[model samples]
Target: MKRFFPIVFTLLYMLAMLKPVLPVFDYVINQDYIAEYLCINKDKPEMHCDGKCYLMQMLEEQNNEKKQNLPAIDLKEYPIGFVTLINLPSETTTTTPQKNHNNYHNQYRFLTSEQHFHPPIFS
Candidate 1:
């Protein structure tokens, strides 16, 4: 009984950590936190990229596209018209500029009094 305490506690701690209620079977069993998402061929025994693996081929295609690329895009080709701005709910009724309130500074303002400072600004 005396020697069994350490072993029992260790087992209980491990069991509590596993948290089988949540989906962590992949991390617990397979030791992988995230499941692989890369496309894998079912028929092939080894990784055999039909063409994609070559870096040079991809770069060449990109360069060729850049050479034939148009100077500017035509908005007519797109189904939706170009939108510059979006209107949302606003609170203010008047277009007039708001006056400065000195409530926080005890009614003393540097800019309003036409005062300027050099470097080491805080001092």
Candidate 2:
């Protein structure tokens, strides 16, 4: 099911990208219907606009909608805030040496713990 979701999403994304072409295909296939009912220059047949005006209007409307959906920002008018950096001194620690023991079992005691078994986050 997880793999199927990506395939379906990719197909859908491709289909959405081809949305503009669908209008041209519709204009080619249904030219007669568009000219008869949807054309703006239906009265002026001398210009030879066989539903081309309707197609242009549809394309222009789509373009306008795309333009409207974009976020408007004016960076020139607004002043940006200044960034400041600070440095801090880190503390040093000294370790004391421990006495060595001859117990081999103590070394393997924490080997099975979850913290050591898990991978390091920094890596």
Candidate 3:
């Protein structure tokens, strides 16, 4: 009984030390956190794009100018097909639906399924 008591106590102590090493599988990085990390303004997220958008706009303008300079090609005169204009969605619109606070929490809850099968290891 004395030996068993020491064994049990050692086991409990090891478990206590290992408890903190367990990974929090439900932990998730949020968009707000990303924004904060990137030092982006919450009110004007467009500012996150910085001058990239402006540069793209300038390139598009140049492309348009080149297209205008080219001689007009009539589709009826040639058998080959030609693309006139490509319509793309505005950058201001988000393709993916925004996740609300509840949705974000729900996503994190679902992410814990992996933890049930394969628990994460913390270093």
Candidate 4:
């Protein structure tokens, strides 16, 4: 009797743990019924009366209707080969050559100097 008590207690605990798992099986079995119940609508005349289909069908129908109602566009109506001309300033010829002083020796005097023997401070 003592050994049977532990076995019965373990079985009860396992069954308690399994209660939550049972709903998943029920949901799987009733999935089709739940889907059919959600899809039904009386207001829309075009939807299937059985309501077994999903909401995607109604959306597809509306999209198709909208596409059919849109005006057709013609590519030929726009002008092709349209050229725009802009007048630019005339180029002037200079007889004298210009001197560039940007690279003069004074600009680079600090970089070329030797570093001090003491450790340099970054700040």
Q: Cα lDDT of all candidates, in order?
A: 0.52, 0.87, 0.56, 0.64
Each model's TM-score? 0.19, 0.58, 0.25, 0.28
Query: Which is better, 1 or 2, measured by TM-score?
Result: 2
Q: What would the per-residue lDDT of candidate 3 be over residues 76-113, giving only the tens digit for each residue?
A: 89865565678998789558877676634444443445
Off by over 4 Å in 2: 77-123
Candidate 1 per-residue lDDT over residues 1-123, each given as its tens digit: 987999999999998776432333433343321223322332453665322223334456656766788477776787565666788888787778879885675765555655666678575
Q: Which ten residues in a row have the lowest lDDT in candidate 2?
A: 107-116
Q: What TM-score would candidate 2 get against the native?
A: 0.58
- Predicted candidate 2 versus true structure: per-residue lDDT over 68-100, tens digit per residue: 999898887665665455577888888889889
lDDT of model 3, residue 109: 42
* Overall local distance difference test of candidate 3: 0.56
**Model 2 lDDT vs. the true structure?**
0.87
Give the candidate order by descending TM-score: 2, 4, 3, 1
Clashing residue pairs in all predictions, respectively, total 0, 0, 0, 0
Which residue ranges in model 3 land beyond 4 Å of their true spot?
1-47, 75-123
Worst 10 residues of 3 by lDDT: 21-30
> Which regions in candidate 1 have their CA more than 4 angstroms from the true location?
20-22, 26-123
Q: In terms of TM-score, how similar is model 3 to the real structure? A: 0.25
